[model samples]
Target: MRVLLTNDDGIQATGLHAMRRALLERVPGIELAVIAPDSNRSASARSITTRQPLAVDEVRFADGERGFATDGTPVDCVRFAVLGLVGEPPELIVSGINHGSNLGDDVTYSGTVAAAFEGALLGIPAIAVSQQAEHGRTDFRPRGRGWAYEDFAAGARFVAELVAAIDGLPLGERTVLNVNVPAGEVRGVRVCRLGRRIYRDELKLESVAPNGRKHYRIYGAEPGYHEEPGTDFEAVADSMIAVTPLGFDLNHERALAELGRVDLQAAFARSIERQELAHEG
Candidate 1:
């Protein structure tokens, strides 16, 4: 089957390479097309470029296989690939084997997860695989800084197996598999719910330039978490692989139940009438 691969960690990242190698070794003869951002696009979410034209370039893998590199977001790579830039709409889109875990609420801002989200949006099954952050050296660039210096053999192997397993239990539309592997060997795989992560502390103003372009640093003091049952964080903390089914729909189902309490239609109508009255006056 044809598979499209991309990552927020950039086209040159080690995790991407490791994933490619592991899949080739384990799956054997599966076709893959790599299209990714030219540089690190971590935390970029599902943002697409509209202001300027995006540029695409051809890049090489370690094995000399050519891949497309674009000066755009991770989602852009998926969009371009599916639009016949790389050929056809792949049956599956595998994003990452990322250098860091996309646990808890971080998925809201994670470009790694966003790439898979885009694929799911296009009616294709997708997976966003990540290794624990501590296992790699991505302290600065999220998942792209120093992945080449770290060993992704174990994580990549886990992803290869996970991909095979997911082939059978295909997810519904608008959903993607959010997989996070432990640092070393995975004790087990647990289906989990998304957890909470709150970054504590104040923003540190690092420096102010003469031109008044102030530079600020938000140093992570310690990430805080809520202890919840069957969460991705709990699974990862227990050194097991965490597989969370994330959905693209952002509608708050529970809150929708209370929608009857507010008169949104009347509110808008009243505001519009008031504006019309003022305009006529």
Candidate 2:
């Protein structure tokens, strides 16, 4: 199978390298191509380049493997790979083996998820893989046992196997799989939904700059973990691979029906007219 691999982490990240090596070693008869950001573009959420021209360059690995690097977000990398870089679209696009977990609300802001979303948008089957770890620590090599490189490699191989077995699969319609593996020996796999994350009061107003303007830096307090029974967070905390099926359409159909009673369209039109009249005055 032809596989296009990409990541939110920059092209040079250890995590990205690990995943690439794993795919090549584990999956047989696989044609691999990579297109990733030139630098880290984490938490960039499906954003596309419009204001500036995208720059893409050919990159060659030490083993003579060729890929492309782009000065854009992960979504842009996927688009470029499918439409511009590769001669043909890949059968599958796998994103990440990301440095951090993209669970629950994190998926809404994740560039890793966004890259997979872009692939799904273009009628390609895609999966986003992430590993949960303690924040700020760089080297995951020490954690390399049940929840380390080898474990993630095993998960990637399992996903490939699953895709191969499923026939007449729906490639289009923005279907994606978000997979998060716990850091350590995994218990098993769980089909889950988005989990909740609770953050303590970490936002603080620091000091101003030279111009005497007030500035604030949002610092994170110690992250706390809460596991609700059937959610992804619970599965991960139990050292299981959490797989959540996600769709790109964000519309809340029930809410649309409830909101229809408010005559919001006419209200918005009148509000715009009032603003225009005030501007003229």
Candidate 3:
């Protein structure tokens, strides 16, 4: 099977490289190609380059596995690859093994999740894996020490096995699996729903220069799940892998049903009559 790997953490990110190695070990007989951002695109979400053209560069992983590094968002990388950037559309797209977990409402602002969304839109099965960075989960070994992927090696391997095992499972249309693995040794994997991520955010003004240009910082809050049952945050809190199926459709079924009860034929007819009268006058 052919697989396309991309991430929001850039081409040289440890998570991306670790995924490549783990997939090679577990998912046998699979062709792999990597296309990701040239730099960190943490919360870029689904933003794509439109004002200007994108740039691509050929890069090699630590093991010499070559890939493409693009100056675009995570979604841009997926669009380019699936739309024939890396030869033809790959059968599957595995995003991330990201540097941090994408849980609950955090998924909305996550480029890691956005890449998977793009894949799902292109009719491909996609999985996004993330390792928890907070709650003492991340391993920070100085600056440029180059051991970022070591801590989450096991999680990356698990993701690869999952991809092979769940190849033919029914995931519905325009759906992607968002997997969040807790740091350290994992206990088990659980299917769960998204949870709320709360934070105390405040706008901070840094300084004003002589030119009257003011600088401000938008600080992002951390994930604080209320330990809700059957939620992705709950699974991660318990040291288990959280797997949530995310879909692109945002239609509110409950609202649609409620609106069904309201009769609008007369309202529509009156609005049409008003328009016709205005035109006649």
Q: Cα lDDT for residue 247, model 3?
A: 91
Estimate candidate 3's alpha-carbon lDDT, on a 0 to 1 scale: 0.84
List model 2 lDDT by residue over 1-281, tens digit each: 88889998888766677778777876778888899999989878988899999998888987788888999999998888788588777888889888778887778888999998888888788889887764232121223333345646656665666555434654446789888877656778999998876655466889987988988868445444466788887777777888898888889999998998888899999999999999999
Residue 244 CA displacement from its true place in model 1, Å: 0.6
What tens-digit string does per-residue lDDT give for candidate 1 at 1-281?
77888999888888898998887778755788999999988889889998999999988766878899999999989999889987777888899978778888878888999999999999889999887766422222243335453457777787787666666785788789998877755688899998888776578998999999998878656566787999988888887788999888988987897886788999999999999999999
Order the candidates by TM-score, highest first — what do you get? 1, 3, 2
Model 2 has an lDDT value of: 0.77
By lDDT, the best candidate is 3
Which stretches of model 1 miss by more than 4 angstroms? 135-150, 276-281
lDDT of 3 by residue, 1-281 (tens): 88999999889888888899898889979889889999999889889999999999999766767999999999999888877878878888899878878888878888999999998988888999888875443221113334466767878888888878866677898899999888766899999999886755668898999999999877743335555799988888788988899998999999999989987888899999999999999
Evaluate all candidate structures by whole-model CA lDDT and list the values in order.
0.82, 0.77, 0.84
Q: Residue 257 CA error for candidate 2 (Å)?
A: 1.3
For candidate 1, the lDDT comes to 0.82
